[model samples]
Target chain A: MRGCADVRALLGDEAVYEAAAAEAFPEYNKAHLVSLELPDRSGDIIITTYGELDKNNYLDPRTAQVATVNHIKQNCTELRPAADEELPSAYIEEFRSALDVELSKYVGEAYPKGVCAVYCTSGKDIEGPGANFGFAAVISAARRSPQNFCNGSWRSIWTLEFSDESQFVEIKGKIQVGAHYFEEGNVQLDTNIDYKYSTILQSAEDCAVSVTNIIRHHESEYLSSLEESYLNLSDATFKDLRRKLPVTRTLFAWHNTLALSLTRDLAKELAIGK
Target chain B: MEAAMDLVRRMPPGSTETALNALLSLLPDHSIDLLSQVDLPLQVCMDKESLKEYILCEYNRDADSYRSPWSNKYEPPLEDGTVPSEDMRNLEIEANEVFSVYRDQYYEGGISSVYIWEDEDKGFIACFLIKKDGQGKRGYMQIGSWDAIHVIQVGPEEEGAAHYCLNSTVMLSLTTDNKQSGTFNLSGSIRRQMSMTLAVADGHLVNMGKMIEEMEGKLRNSLDQVYFGKTKEMVCTLRPPPEVLNMRLPDR
Candidate 1:
């Protein structure tokens, strides 16, 4: 059985990506690298501190400022890791860059206190590192002050290991708020407050199994069709993946995107403002 | 023997009644009057209505007097209170028309096949092979007597083609015996929906009218083979080749 190629390889040539990034951001090469074990400790991710080693810039600013305040609010916490699984070492930079792009869009005036960056290195068996923009934590920290953390985004990363040749990793993040924080400048606090995420998943597993489970409803044709869209991973596109492996997408959305979105709303419900 | 040969010569060829009459005429003059009904048709027993009547007579003869009222006595009410007379009349008229039309079509080359078996005891069986236009669409239709345990089955020659069977009067089956193996027994409506879903998935369901027309053509072709083969077998069984009939006739 021919196993699938690495997900990075499937995406495109790595040299082109590195060259493009170097041309786009000169600061990208000059950044100082620091590895931190994630809070839940699934693995570690390497953080590139764009040209500086200042640790203060990465911690939530609201938490740093709240030390001066007399009244301290409860710190909003994150959901614990469901399982201690590590991501692959070779794919860490890709994961970090993807998260960086997603989180950069959320660090606007909408989140009054601004966003923070954090990194986690791969585990004992894992070689890659992952990064997250602590947008949800920023909101929680912001809630400690008299500021309303209304609109922003947060990220989540999930890694799954199949006993076979390829490893499946999904990187997704929440982008938009569902409820109106304040109506006509009056706070209309409703229990229906929710957060929704735009999801993206990258999986490198046996193409046959992935594609079959994608269309699990049509179980009858899975085996014969295993080689067609599935093993043809040499140049499989997102559209092809979406069409062929719909179940994988649903699973990725459920595990990474929906789970993260729920965690954000759960944090708000538990301790963010109240 | 001489009188029996004369009676056989006088009777019309291919008339089961005449054949039975000739056979009975072979009996001694004293014993000829013993049989109350001596002119029954040779193939009359195979007719659907005759079969039903024979079954009813046998059942009633052996039936216990205390048998439950709900037991199938093979006696259905001619006029039931639940069914209006007008509706019943309409149904009977429609049924007669359908049978007549199909019978006419079935006899006139509607089906096509070779008769492999023609035995009065074992009954008629037709062996037919149909190769559809597409490459993977070859199959065989094995049709036996209507009352046979395994009456009819349409199956792919190898695999990958659609398969269906009518095992009994009440049982209709669709089989997925391609790379995968699964079978579904569905009613008329459910089967229609399933085939429609398959057609839609294949992008041929854009025009239902055309799809239905194509289906009708396919069905007619298949039925033509099945019925035509079956009819040939039955014809051979009821009226043996003239040479064999002549060999069986008493010498002048």
Candidate 2:
């Protein structure tokens, strides 16, 4: 082991003075007490020797001061994980769940490329002067959150890659929530989007609507005729909507929309008070 | 020069699909009286889709709405690392595409018809082509192995529709107002086979007897479906009722 004076004289860093002082006040060591602040983008100095600077004997009792200090300095970056994983302190998994869960709803209803990514900076119960855990933790929680789409597993997400060579509107704005603090348990995102279907959707919608309309027109007629035939039934008021027969289909199974339409129409006419 | 430049400027880049809209069979059944009056003058852009309201208005079926069935509730989030494949041909469409595939090949008469969406707007080149049937004159569409190939429009409504409690539909009807004077009549199709190969394939088939009956039966049904689909479009133009169309009008 080396003496405090000898160690200091051998390898000098002014920061070691604090280490000496803290050694004198062994019960009240400042080693684990200082505040650490992380930056918004990058460049956060996670390792600090300020406490050592103030105390002369901070690393004296343990002769491994220089080696340990060098090692800690090298490896002491903030514990920001590159991907979702179990670690000392990171909220990336939580954030991803939040974003994904919300995005799932758009599967068939809206295309994925229409969505944009944004940073969330609001959450409650954040601890400490660094505000690092508070904002970033909550942001990670939001990003990793799962978004459920109404259509369920059958429909899937689709993305349109960004390309400047094409005239498509590949670039657009995304809504982001920054460090949000929720007093209550639920995190309420109060954001709205102003979007219109791209030209692609408009064409698809038009064709879909047109085809649907044509099918509806024919099925409606078919069902009405069925109702007239039912006129002969003495007490044919059975609204058993799930009766599957050999289905002597006057129309081919090809015209599914028409069949559904006719059924839906008759349901209303029957309108059995349920 | 200006018009050509305008057309050029209007073209979307690197995309072949464009959305186009044309009126469909929105008229009521009573307008059947006007059938001959107008002489079927309306040239279809694409075979009209059987919409819910149209079915309700014309046939007895209620499709619920004209909007695509695919909504947030029906839509599921795509898996991570999803890569959208190119517009594939012969990717083998799903079972749901039975009718659409039929419409594309048999109805469109050839492979050129399409329903595509490029820039938010979707359009279908309304086309239904069926060759003359086997007897050579009935005009019944030739049913062949390729008939198994049906293209689905891939929208929300087709997958599911609570058919009028199933099997209970006796006969479908239609209704329209007066102030219209004309005779309404539809002739049978002289469906001859489009090719000799199809004719031979169909002739030697085991289900030949049932195939003919089914093909004939489906033709009528598809026509009815297309007609009713048009009716739904018409209702949208006028006023739509949730009960008439099926589901309640969307909020707003």
Candidate 3:
């Protein structure tokens, strides 16, 4: 287990100080929060530091101070017993149900017109001795302009499973947001996050929170930004939206040939009169 | 020019053919010589027949239960294996009567028809059609057609609150021909969908009628804007004005 002092030493005093300064004044901290994974691949730690400089002095190295620290453990082996305890079928069923219950709360709160569904499957592989179990929860919402000129849809899916051959549990999640416009183009954003946790409850809670945060971010930030950019692009190229000739100019003349026939009739009439 | 004249002469005499030939005979030699250089034809008699046939085919297809353009509520060949129920038949008659009045109000002189069918257990679908064909002296002819199809799906009513999904399409086509200026054709369609949840207890028919009325008004405005405003802009881009056409000519 690596402590805060060890992480600080590894990152060096100068880097840690800059990170601390970023935490205090995020605007001034252009580098943002830096996350480093430990060598053992057990977890990741995010550190933010702060520093103040004298406004009047041109050359001054301010003292470094710690602002905030976050430690996320990825490998949670304590969830299972130390012995080679086989996960029972009943336990797996309970876990799946609990995951559904946990994710359903966020689904309802996040999307008014959305739908959420849970799927679970368990079976013994033909070549393996142990049974494999998988659980997935999904939520989707979509809306379109009345004329279908533009439309947008968002979906998030979270899955937890363990294969018969692997002793570790796998947790994966993905969020996809997309919008299509008839005149402009398509905008798509996809994010994927995965971790290895032995316990099902913790993974489910983590997935729910992550999914909710992603949805909130897209609703509040990405969607509006995309709309503004698309509007700007359309305005800048409004003249190009004009309709163009559907056919070649030469091929278009074929339709005019019909009028010449009427002219020929007039010529015949004049000749007969002469 | 000779081939086109032969084609027109071989056509069966109809009102359109007679009008076109009369206009041709009246043209003077100088005008005829100039027009002969361009390779364009006015309206041909066959075009009228084909347009009529196309309209009839569309109407017939709509009438068939198996080939309904809108979503069908009941599966084809009902319990008794009959296509339309008596209720649907009555609704169609009522729609036709109402839409014909609407057509007369908007069009100079035209024919109108309306068809209504059950969508599912929830709601219904209605289609309104209007076609107008006219011809004038000097080989001038115009044809205008409009189709408006509406699909209304009702959601479960809760605490006197009703939800409805309305999907509609409005298609308009206008083709005009002139002896001197050739022909211009404008045709396009727009589709829109709207969902409404209302606390009012208005019947579905009343809601549908109101929606259709509003949609028709909007469609007319959109057509006017696109046809008159956009077409004018596009034409100006394609060809310069009369003043600019002769700008480079020097005094002879």
lDDT of 3 by residue, B1-252 (tens): 342332222222123236344335544433454343221212111113223211221222322322221222222333332345667666564455444444444443455545555666545555555554443122222543444555556665578876777766554444443332223344444566777876546444455556655665555555444333343332222222335435534642
lDDT of 2 by residue, B119-199 (tens): 222311111111211111122212211111111222122223211100101111111111121111111111212111122
**Candidate 3, CAPRI quality class derived from DockQ:** incorrect
Please give each candidate's TM-score. 0.16, 0.15, 0.31
lDDT of 2 at B239: 27
By TM-score, rank the candidates, best first.
3, 1, 2
| lDDT for each candidate structure | 0.25, 0.23, 0.40
Candidate 1 off by > 4 Å: A1-94, A109-125, A128-168, A171-187, A191-274, B1-252
Q: After superposition, how far is residue B216 of candidate 1 from its true place, in Å?
A: 68
Q: Provide chain B TM-scores across all predictions.
A: 0.20, 0.20, 0.53
**For model 2, what is the alpha-carbon lDDT of residue B182?**
12
Highest TM-score: give the candidate number.
3
Cα deviation of A142, candidate 1, in Å? 5.5
Candidate 3 — which residues are off by over 4 angstroms?
A1-274, B1-93, B119-121, B131-141, B156-161, B198-202, B242-252
Error of 3 at B25 (Å): 44
The DockQ of predicted model 3 stands at 0.01
